[model samples]
Target: MFFEGFSLVTQDVQGVRYRFRSGGTAPDAIFLLHGRPETHVMWHRVGPLLARYYTVICPDLHPERSPEQQVNDLLTLATITGHDKFVIVGQDYGAHLGYLTAATAPDRVQALVLMEALPAATHEGRDDMAFSLAQYNSCWFAQLHPKPESHTIPVPAEWLEKPLPAESVFAPEAVADYLSASIWQHARTVTWAAACHPIRCPVLVLWAASGRIGGWYDPVRRWCDVTSAPTEGHAINGLHFLAEEAPGDVETAISLFLEHCIPE
Candidate 1:
């Protein structure tokens, strides 16, 4: 992957280990934070696109873990990369840490884009979806399993292209990625637990056209109310994995947003 331009560097910040992927050169950095059971690969399309214009760094934050731990990992990775200031883009669990990093040290983050994610709030955060009996049961089993499992499905690549009201929210690639990644279970649980807190930053909440996780609109609104940061919601015409499902649209939105933070 051309996005794998940055060497495999290790960072030990506050006892958290961070593995990062980098592309491009220059000090103006764009940091990518990935969610649970996933690696820097989640930004497969987005990272390279951003790298075309700015230094793109994507790090996998083993979500099933603690924010402090993830933060430590990011801190160490940043130190190793010689990045003192950067823009943070987080999705799902990654979004939580993006806010935490900015809130803990506002100086570090120039801007933040939260994709299909919300602050760490358990009660009623935007990312916290209200699942039905079947959905809740499935999630329970997932939590109970405490590890990733393979999900058999047909036409995996076109899974996202299907219309709303999907029978399954995950595609084969997503399933494989989740199961293979480290800290899968720990990341999902901790992400929800962290959502109980508030974050301060220029936040963007993206909603999926057909939400398979939980009810959509209200949670995003609630998330905006709790976080004093400038927040807006745009409904993407796809499933949860909008980046892969609708790369062009996602890239356009991201490019437009980043232009505000780093003109060029």
Candidate 2:
């Protein structure tokens, strides 16, 4: 009953099999991309909420493919799903992919919602002592020639840290879904990249108010440098996992941004 009205769909794109969840009946569509250590299940809470206003698509990204291929897969997924254009909502690593997708296909992406992410170039450009220390595991993972599944599959309990707001622990099913997917090569394949073309669609940057992103950089200003279109930024009341920790706040921010930026 988590994704009450949603249906699981499996399709082949460019010789690769892809699995995704599709739901809602609106003409407008939204593509939700999950981050590192998570599958489509990361959006379990927010997907259903956004489904009320738009057809929601949440896909499990392949770790072995390059970011370019992944972006193409997403665009092709949209085409096969009968959407000429759609809103992309991505968090962390997925946010990086979303940025590339918008840059790669501006006409097809109506708007972009980037959560807990900055441009790949921005991230590389600002790799400092603090970033290196905070993301040491990520840096190490990137360098590994053959990433180990044992290290990648399990959801580190530290990621879903304690002291969360009452009853906000991530669901067991969701955690299981994440573990089922192979994310061994995601860090190596997706994280570091060259600068992409400037984004033309409207952009909304959301980050955790208490997270390293807000503390490390000015998200709005950084995004302004990469996108030619108007950029708006907001800090949600949680840590890095905004969708899971603050779904209500995340949903509200996205709804408001879409209402103002993308006309129906």
What's the true lDDT of residue 87 in model 2?
A: 95
* Model 2, total clashes: 0
Candidate 1 global TM-score: 0.73
Residue range 1-264, candidate 1, lDDT tens digits: 434455555556566666667787866888888764466777767777777777888876666566776676676677677888788877777777887777666667777777776444544433333343234334544553443243422224343353423655444555555556655544345534443344555666665677653353454675675677776667778867776677677778777876776645
Clashes of each: 10, 0
TM-score of each: 0.73, 0.87
Candidate 2 lDDT by residue in tens digits, 95-174: 88898899899889999999998776766757776576576356446555665333442456544554433464577677
- On TM-score, the leading prediction is 2
How well does candidate 2 score on lDDT at residue 121? 71
Q: Where does the lowest 10-residue lDDT sum fall in candidate 1?
A: 147-156
> What is each predicted model's overall lDDT from 0 to 1?
0.64, 0.83
Off by over 4 Å in 1: 1-17, 122-179, 185-188, 191-200, 212-215
What lDDT score goes with residue 198 in model 1? 46
